[model samples]
Target: MIFLFRIGFLEVSWVDIIDIALVSVLLYQVYKLIRGSIAVNIFLGILALYLVYLIVRAAQMELLATILGQFMGVGVLAMIILFQPEIRKFLLVIGRGTEFRENLFKSIAQWRNSYHEDVNVNEIMEAVKTLKATRTGALIVFSRDVELKFYVETGDVLDATVSKRLLLSIFNKNSPLHDGAVIIYKGKIKAARCVLPVSENDHLPPHFGLRHRSAIGMSENTATLVMVVSEETGRVILARNGIYLRGLKLKQIEQKIVEYLQNTEPANWEEISEEEPTTTEN
Candidate 1:
């Protein structure tokens, strides 16, 4: 390798610069993934332990160094266990980036037209508008390429057609099924009162409640579009691929759903509407 420069005893080269750049990018991505969660604290704790281990070993403290060395030896497995969700999310990101996955998703979109029917977007929009007006909280999950049977099994099977009336009734504050989420697939309500995994993202605004967190978690884990209506503020929030758009108008929400179903990218927030600014709490 050709050396570019020398810093005292250390030689810097093009390969070294490239290696450092790649490692920096990787660390940045990992930090972004776990930034707002409990995983960050755990990550820091592990880093601290490693630092201590290095110090002890350098000082020739044999007893402490040996114990720390053993811990370090098992750190890889321990990290896998402790950060399972983060690891899964990381792998999912990598998988999504592959050309094969993109082609597969495109194929799935085509298959929907021949095999699976789409849900009534108008009915869903109407129900969401009503829920927002009435300050009735609701979580609705729309399945995409992935089959969410595992999550569906967690709730009551509905097998009912999608309708504004049915959605309103299901999410009525007094209704028993109002507490959990409703899963929609193939133009039908496949399940109701489904328990979704709540996100541990600490970066989520403190104002966001359990409903929003659950929506984020479900979206992160699956290729689904999740809608959440805040019970407290009557704000309509839409989540896709773990990205949450808060205070969206009914028209904006409809357009997003339509675009997503049509296998096209949704309009950016700025393009959605300038008159109605999207507000993200926190």
Candidate 2:
């Protein structure tokens, strides 16, 4: 191997440079995927501990090295458990990217945007408008690509047609099924009062509550759109890709929903981001 440069007594080679560059790129991509979540801090803590372990080993502190070494031995499994959601999302993105061109046409359901005519989205917006006007808290999930059967099973299954009256009644303050989320898939209300995973983002605004956290969490774990209507303020907010879009009018929200169903990535959200800083679970 040829040394390209020297840092004191240490030699640097092109091969080493290439290896470092690739690792850095990988780390950057991982950071991008997990940055807004609490996983970033956990990842940093693990990295710091590993660096300390290396230093302890170099210093010949066998007692400390042995302790950290034991942890390092099972680090891979620990990371897999801790970062299960993030890992799944990363891999999903990679897999989708690789096969996107090949599967673009054959997968009819993936083109769920086509369901626009069938989904009766008008009823949802009307229901949300009423909910907002009444200051009633509501959590609604729209999933076109995936059935979200697991979360759907968490609540009472209605499997009824999409309609404003049904949505309004289900989310009514006194309704038994108003406590959790309502999942709409394939133009039907599959379930009501469904529980969703809560997010672990600690930097959320003080005003955000459990509903907002759940919305963020569900988006983090699945390719779904979550709409949260604030009980306190009657504010309408949307969650997708673990990012929140706040203060959107019904028209904008409808547009975004259509875009999301079409499998389009959010291009610009800076305006709403300025309105609220963005959830928490342990």
Candidate 3:
């Protein structure tokens, strides 16, 4: 309460505003990291305990304050131990951001345009047709901006050119690499047999299998398109926008991929069906 040029104690300073802004930013980042996580409960618990400790200390309760003070002294180390997984995940996310990666949207937009200009859509169509023809089960994840390094770490890193034969071999039942999803980035197969997240959709059709669920999960988590084909039925499925498009034929799948890849727009399955037939007679 020192006198600092205030007529009626309406004192404020630039340092106070700066401190508030810094705290706000830190809290916002923490909220982002802990959202949809159980670590938030642990955080609130620590905060509540701190408030109680402060109250006890202020009331001149020697025993309670002494016990609470001891807890407070080791609280930070306890928190780090208890929330080890969450803390590691948060640090990984922050580290990834500072790893000198290029802009995500710009990279995606480049791929979208490059696929149309540089890549051979006919060859891709041929591969898609071949995949459907053999009734080969396949899961191909096309990565855009968001990195799938965690999932990629779980698989064999190929970093090879995307080709029909390579994709077919990976998805062939007899092949060693047929077990998991292939992650493609910038026209290269960055990883093969990569495990992916699974969707918990209750309304999914009974026929939908694990590959579809994993594809939906990957799509939901990142800005990527997951293409899945069922080996038993030769049916094609595309996972994007957190929705699964089941029973898509070659042309429809191609169109949907081009639409999402090039435009980043939500597709209307109904409109697509009305505009083009699902099947093409041989």
> What TM-score do all the candidates reach, one by one?
0.60, 0.61, 0.60
User: In candidate 2, what are the lDDT values of residues 86-157, reduced to their tens digit?
Assistant: 898668656776543333332333434444435887888888889999999999998865566557878999
Task: Give the alpha carbon lDDT tens digit for every residue of 1-282 in model 1.
Answer: 899999999999999999997676667556645654567768899999999999999999999999999999999999999999889767766676663355445444563464557879999988887888889999999875444655788999999999999999999988999999999887889999999988767889888889999998877656678889999989878877667886576788888777766556645532464355454422
Report the candidate with higher lDDT, 2 versus 3: 2
What ordering of candidates by lDDT runs from best to worst?
1, 2, 3
lDDT of 3 by residue, 1-282 (tens): 333355476675666667787676556545544543346667899999999999999999999999999999998899999879667766775677753133333343464454422233455567778877888888888765434667788999998877777777777789989999988776677898898878766777677789888887776655677888888877787776466666666677777766655654555532473354442110
User: Which candidate leads in lDDT?
Assistant: 1
After aligning candidate 1 to the native by TM-score, how far in Å is the CA of 95 from where it should be? 24
Give the better candidate number (1 or 3) by lDDT: 1
RMSD of each: 10.5, 9.6, 9.9
lDDT for model 3: 0.70
Number of backbone collisions per candidate, in order?
1, 1, 0
Displacement of the residue 83 alpha carbon in candidate 3, Å: 13
